[model samples]
Target: MKLSALLPFARLLCVTTLVAASAAQAQQVLNVYSARHYPSDEILYAGFTKKTGIQVQRVDSDDAGIVARLRAEGAASPADVILMVDAARLWRGESMGLFQPVKSAVLDAAIPATLRGAPDAQGASSWYGFSTRARVVVFDPAKVKREDVDTYEELGDPKNKGKLCLRSGSHPYNLSLFGAVLEHMGEAKTEAWLKGMVANLARDPKGGDTDQIRAVASGECAIAVTNSYYLARLMHSTKPEDLAVADRVQVVFPNQASWGTHVNIAGAAVAKHAPNRAGAIQFLEYLSSAEAQEVFSDANNEWPAAKGVKVNNSALQRMGGSNFKSETIPISAVGGNSLKVQQMLDRVGFK
Candidate 1:
C-alpha cells in the first residue's frame, strides 16, 4: 500500500475520534430549567455534580415563567430537568405534556405515592415531590386562643371576624391550600368558607407569608395563614426582628384533628424533550436521596418528601411539626382543584 493511500484513512480516524470526544463532553453536562430561586439551592446542584461528575447548567425563573419558557421552546428546548416549587404548576406542566413519565425504582421506593404525580399506565410518574411546606395558621396568642384558630375551618368563623390576614387567595400557595380545603369540604362549603374568610379579613389579602406573619406580630391582625417553612425561616433566623416575629406568634398545623394539615410540595421532573434523558433521570433520583432531602429541610426549612429521611433542622423541631399529621390527599387532586379555588376567591372578593 502507498503512504498517500494510508494518509486518507489516518484523517478519517482523527475526525471520528474528535466527534466521539465532543459527544462525551456533551454527556457530562445537564441543563436545568428551575423555578427554585433560593441561594441555598446552589449547594444542591453542586452536590449532584460532586457525586455524579455531571455539571449542572441552570436557568432560573419563577414557576410561571419557567412553564411559559418551556412552552415557547417546545421540542427544541435543551432542558434536561425541570424543578418547580408548586403542585399546581407541576400539574399544569404535566397536563401540557411538558414532563416525560419517569420510571425509577429508587424514586418509587423513596417517595410516598401521595407526594408524587399520579403514575401512568406503565407505573411511571410525571414528577416527584422532593420537599413539603405545610399551610399553617399563625396567630397572636394575646388576641386569639389556639383552639379558636386551630383548624382551617375556624379561620372563617364569625367569632374571628375582622382578625384574619392572608396573602392573595389566587397565589399558588393559597390555591393549593384552598384546593385541599375543597377536597375535604366540597364546592358549596368551600365557597362559603372563602366568603367567611373575606368577611373576616383584618385587611385586604396582601404580601407574602412572612409579611402576613409579621403583620400578626405587629398586631395588625390577630390571625394569619402562612406556610410552615416561612415560620421556620423566622424561627431559624439570627436577626432580632425575625426572632421577635417568631416569638410573637403561635403556629398551628391546621386540621390535625381531621384529615391533617394541608401540605404542598416543591417537585421536579424530566423535561419531555430532554436532550440528556439518562442524566435527567439521574438528577431526579439524586433529589430523592437522603442527603438532598436534608438540604431541603436544613437549608430551606422544607420537610423531606422521601420516606424515612430524618432532618436535623432545629427550626423544624422548634415549630413542633416533626410529628404532625399531614393530609394524605393526592397532590394531583390539589392541583386539579386550583382553577375552581381561584374562581371561588374571585366570587368572594378574597383579593
Candidate 2:
C-alpha cells in the first residue's frame, strides 16, 4: 500500500525540482547600471547575450545618479556591473567602495595598464577602461593657423584671447583635461594656466563639446576644446549640417610636441556586491575583447583601449595619425586630481 502511495509523491517532487532548476537557468541575468549614453551600446549587450545565452538588464543614468542609486541600494543592489564614462567618475565609484577588485587574465591582457585602475603588487584591477576619446583642440582653419595652435597651452596665450570657446568647467571632460595638466605642471602653474584660459574665453563656458564644435563652425569661436569623437560624430552624421560643421573645423592633437594629447575613458567595473559575479566578470572580459572593443568604440567614434587594437573609424584616424602619441601620465592620476582641477577652475572664474 505504501509503495503505490509514495511513488506519485516522489515523481511530483522530482518534476518540481527539475522545473525550478530550469527556471533558474533561464533567469541567468547580469544587471548593469551604466552612465554611458551611447545608443550603440545596445548592440554590444545584444552581442553578449547572443554569445553567452545570459540576459542583460540595464538602467541608464547620469554618473552622479548612478553613484547615488548604487549607494542607496548597497548590498541589495541589482547592479552586477557599473559602466561609466570618464576616469574620475570611475575612480569616484571605486573610492566610495562601490566596486570589487577583479582579476581576469583576459582583462589584464586586453586592456592597457595605463587605462585601468592602479594595480597593487598582485595586479588585480578595480576597474577597466575599454574605450577612449581624446580631448583635443578644434580650430577653424580659416580663422586660426595650425602653427599658432600647436599645443593646449597655446590656446591660453594672450594672442588667442577672445578667440577660444570651451565647455563648462564642471563637465568631467574638461576637468579630466585640466587634471592632467595639474599632474604635469604643478598646482601653481596649472592654476595660472587656468586663469589664462579663462581670460581667453571667446564666450563664457556654456555648452558641451558638440556645442563648442558647432560654435567653431559658425565662426562664433575660432578655437574650441572638445573630444575628438564629437568632431568625428559630426563628420559621420547623415545630416548635411553636421557634415558642414565637421568641414569647418580641423583637429589639432594638442601637446604633440611635448606631453602628447590628453585622453579620457569610458570604462566599467564590477559591483562590490554583485549577485552574479561570474557573469559580470565574463561581460567585463567580453568588453575588453578585440571584437567588442572595436564595436563599442567605433560606434561612438572612440578609440579602443586594448593594446594592439586600432581605431578603424576613418574620421578618427584622419584627425590623428596612426602614430599619434598619448600622454604617459596614468589616468588614475587624472582622476585623483579631478577635485583640485575643479577648485582651480572655480577660482579662475572658468564657467
Candidate 3:
C-alpha cells in the first residue's frame, strides 16, 4: 500500500537473487524483458556487467509481447525486470499488474517524478519512465518553411492538406503523441487535431518514422513528425538511402510555446513477483548511472535520462542537441488515453 512499506521487500529482493542465481565468482544475473532491440543496449548491458558484476539477461520484443508474457507468467514469470520504449506500454503493463512499485531514494532523485506515475495512475502500472525522447516535426527545407509549422495542430490546417507525412496512428509513438495532446487540449480538441492530421496526410499512414522522412524526401509530403533519434540515426547511418533521407529532412522541435516537443521515455521496473528482485533494482540503478547512460546514449543515438551527460555525435547535436524541456503534460496521461486516441485516429480516416 505505502511506498515505504515496499522498500524493505524491494531491498531484500536485491540480495535474494544474488544468492539464487550466482556462484561465489559468478555475478548475480537479472532477467530483463526489454522492448528495446537497439545494439546500443547490448553495449550498455556489457558495461553494466563490467561495472556492477551483475549479468544482464535481456529478452528483446515489442512492449505488448513483454506485457502479455508477464501477465501469462503470473507468479512464475522469470522476468526480473522490464525495459520498454513508450511510457504508455509501461503504464499499460502497470495497469495489468505486471510490475511492482520499487523504492529507491537514488532512483527517485535520478528520475523525474512526473516521468514515473504512482500506482494510482494504473492502480497497477507501478513503473516509471526513465529515458527522454521527443516526438518532433521535420521538413524538407526546400519544400516547407520552418515557420510554416510550429504547433502539431497546424499540420492539419486545410491549406496544408495532403502535405504532411506520418506513420500509422496505431504505432505506439504516435499514440503517445496523441495521448499528450488529449491530456492538454481535452478529447474534443485532440480529436479535432487528429482529424486535421489525418486529412493532411500525404497518403495513408504507412511505414515507420524513417518512411515518413523518406516520404518527405520523395515529395510525398513536405512535413513529417518523428522522433528526434530516428532523424539522428539517419544522419549518422552509413546506408546511402538513410543518409540521403537524412540529407533531405530538416529537423524542427514543435509546440515550443505551450507544450514543447512531446517527449516520452523508455524505462525499466522490477517485477512484482520477481524471482530475482535485488538484482533487478541494481540493474535499474546501473542503467541510470553515468557510464551506462553514456554508452547507451552514444551507441543507441538517444538522449540520456540523467542530466549533464555529454552527447558525442554531431548528428545528435544538430537535431536539437539533447534539450529535455519536455511537453507540459505527463506521459502517463498519454498512456491513459491511448485507446481513445487510436479510435480518433481511425475515425479521422488514418489507416
lDDT, candidates in the order shown? 0.93, 0.88, 0.79
- Once superposed on the true structure, which residue ranges of model 2 sit more than 4 Å away at CA? 1-27
Tell how far residue 135 is off in model 2, in angstroms.
0.5
The deviation in Å at residue 156 for candidate 3 is 1.2
Model 1 segments beyond 4 Å from truth? Answer: 1-11
Best by TM-score: 1
Q: Candidate 3's residue-wise lDDT over 242-329, tens digit each?
A: 8988888787788777767888888888887887777778887777777877776677777777756677757778776765357756
Best-performing candidate as measured by lDDT: 1
Give TM per candidate.
0.97, 0.93, 0.88
Across residues 1-351, which tens digit of lDDT does each residue of candidate 1 receive? Answer: 999999999999999999999988989999999999898899999999999999999999988798888899999999999999889989999999999999999999999999889899999999999999989999999999999998999988999999999999999999999999999999999999999999999898888999999999999999999889999989888899999999999998888889999999999999999999999999999999998999999899999999999868998888884689989999999998989998888898888
Candidate 2 lDDT tens digits, 132-250: 88888889999899988878888778989899999888788888998998888899988998898889888888978999999999999999998888888888899999999988888
- The window of 10 residues in a row where model 2 has the poorest summed lDDT is 316-325
The reply for model 3, stretches above 4 Å from the true place, is: 1-27, 119-125
What total of clashing residue pairs does each candidate reach?
A: 0, 0, 5
